[model samples]
Target: MNLKEIKLAPFIKLIFIIAIIAYVVLNTDIMGFVSKGISPVLTAFIIAYILDYVVRFFELKMKVPRSLSILISILLFLLILTTIGLFIVPRVVGAVSSLIKAIGNFEFDINALSQLDFDNFYLNEIQQAIVDTVTPLIQKLTNATGTAVLIVVNEVQKITSGLISLVISFAISIYMLGEKRDLLARIKRTLFAYLSDQTANQVLYASRMANKIFKAFFLGKLLDSTIIGVLAYLVFTIFNFEYALLIALIIGLTNMIPYFGPFIGAVPAAVITLIANPSSPIDVVWILICILAIQQLDSLVIGPFILGDSVGVSAFWIIVAVTVGGATFGIVGMFMGVPVLVLLKTLIEEDVEKRLAFQGYEGFQSNDIKNKKSRK
Candidate 1:
């Protein structure tokens, strides 16, 4: 092919995009620059994205003016922050301190083990092993607690230093929300300027899909987890469970992680309860039972009601997403993994169907598969 006759525009654009991505990924200086410069903007976008729903609720449902809706959403957001800072943080900190202290003061009763009538050699060895492990285990626990506290202190310092950025982000988010329509229009205009109609439309569709998935997953999960946490706190307080606030916070935060979250929160909470009230092992049992009931309620009723088909993936894929995402990017990854997977699944399915149709191939549609399953 003649060099001038060959269309190099698409290839050039693809190379430019790949190069930018590679540079962002592989260059430390560029990564640092992005973190410093773009972090606030990104944070602001996330805040505005979340608040947009509340803004819409006020504007559309309550018939409030758009500006007034934005103002109300901002106030509500600030009120929630104030409440968490004033009431929840201190209690959670105190609970952590108390838990550490309790762990330190806990003593394994080897004498109780000795009181058992089992005289087998294996039993004796097992008892001896337990005796040997207790002291080191306590020491390790103390060290881990200290490390965790130090990490929290460091994180607090980082947050304190980033307060200016937080303020700026808040301001940016407000502006973004206020001019959302114009901002979106500008973005769409830019996309169409550089891309063909088909490509631009695909990009727009993907953006919409991503927005829908993220909004539904994050907002629904947040509401569900908050309710679960409140219910847990009430149950714990009524039953006089130890570290109710702390355990409830743990449960709520972990509940943001799908599938494995309840178990993760329950394990640590149960361990703490058991350690704190060794004399009354029955209290641990009750705590476990209560947590189980709460999880059951969430999974059966609350989660389904709120999340619905937001994550249109199977349990197996969700588990895979959570595991892979967590392994790759920690807690944030775990929380985001399902929706990301769902979006990717959707886009891939659409592309595959398009290609199959172009090739005149007959294939099973997802809706048809679902209909068949329902009929069965």
Candidate 2:
């Protein structure tokens, strides 16, 4: 084909789009600028999205005006945040202080292992080896107490420094909630103006799917984590576990990450418990048991009830997503990976089925695969 006769417009457009994406991805300065500049707006949008449900409930269920509903939702959000600041924050800080003090004073008793009566020589050797291994590890951790405390202080400073940005974001969220309909209408108008009807409809449908998946996953996960945290706190309090508030907070926050969160939270909690009462090694065992029980309850009952196939992905994929996302983008990625995977999975499946149908072939659905596996 003659070079001029071959239509290069579509290829050029594709190349331009790819080049733009590559530039954004590869440029560190641009990435930093986007993160620093756009984070507040992104935060505001997320806040408005989450609070939209509460606004809707108030408007539809209570016969409240839309403006009044938005105001109430914002007030409720502020109330919850203020309560956490007043109550939870202080306790967590105190817990951290106590933990640091305890770690500073902690000493591993290597001599204690000599007092243990082991019938077998191998058992005695194994016990000694464990003590020898754990002693240096504990000493290293104890020595790093100051570093840990400094890190905590630095994090607190960062939070305090970000307050202005947070306030701005909150203000932005208020405006977003107030003018949600107009904003959405404008978005739709722009999309339709720029794209064909079918393409615009597809974009809207995908966005709605994403919203549903994200809302369900996030809200359900929050509720589920809250319940687990409360239950864990109660259990810890009953058992007189040390640093209950701090550990509970860790568990709650980490629980937002799928698959690996329980284990991640449990390790630090168990370590803290063990360090607090090294003489009573059974304390660590008790802590582990309690955490395991709470996680089981969450996984078996509360999580299922709340999430209820909202992720729409299998355990293997969820694990893969969480692992890759955590590796690539840290905790936020870990928490978001599942819903993103679900959205992508849904879109791909739909497209594949459509293509298969066009090719005069019936798609091999999920149920068919399940039946084949059962036969195997």
Using all chains and alpha carbons, the TM-scores for the candidates as numbered come to 0.83, 0.88
Q: How do the residues 128-247 of candidate 1 rate in per-residue lDDT, one tens digit apiece?
A: 787677657656765676676677678778887688898899999999999999999999999999999999998899899898888988999999999999999999999998899989
Candidate 2 regions with alpha-carbon error over 4 angstroms: 1-29, 114-129, 365-367, 370-376
The global Cα lDDT (0 to 1) of model 1 is: 0.83
Q: lDDT of each model, Cα atoms only? A: 0.83, 0.84
Residue-pair clashes per candidate: 0, 0
lDDT of 2 by residue, 179-244 (tens): 898999999999999999999999899999999989999999999999889988999999998888
lDDT of 2 at 160: 67
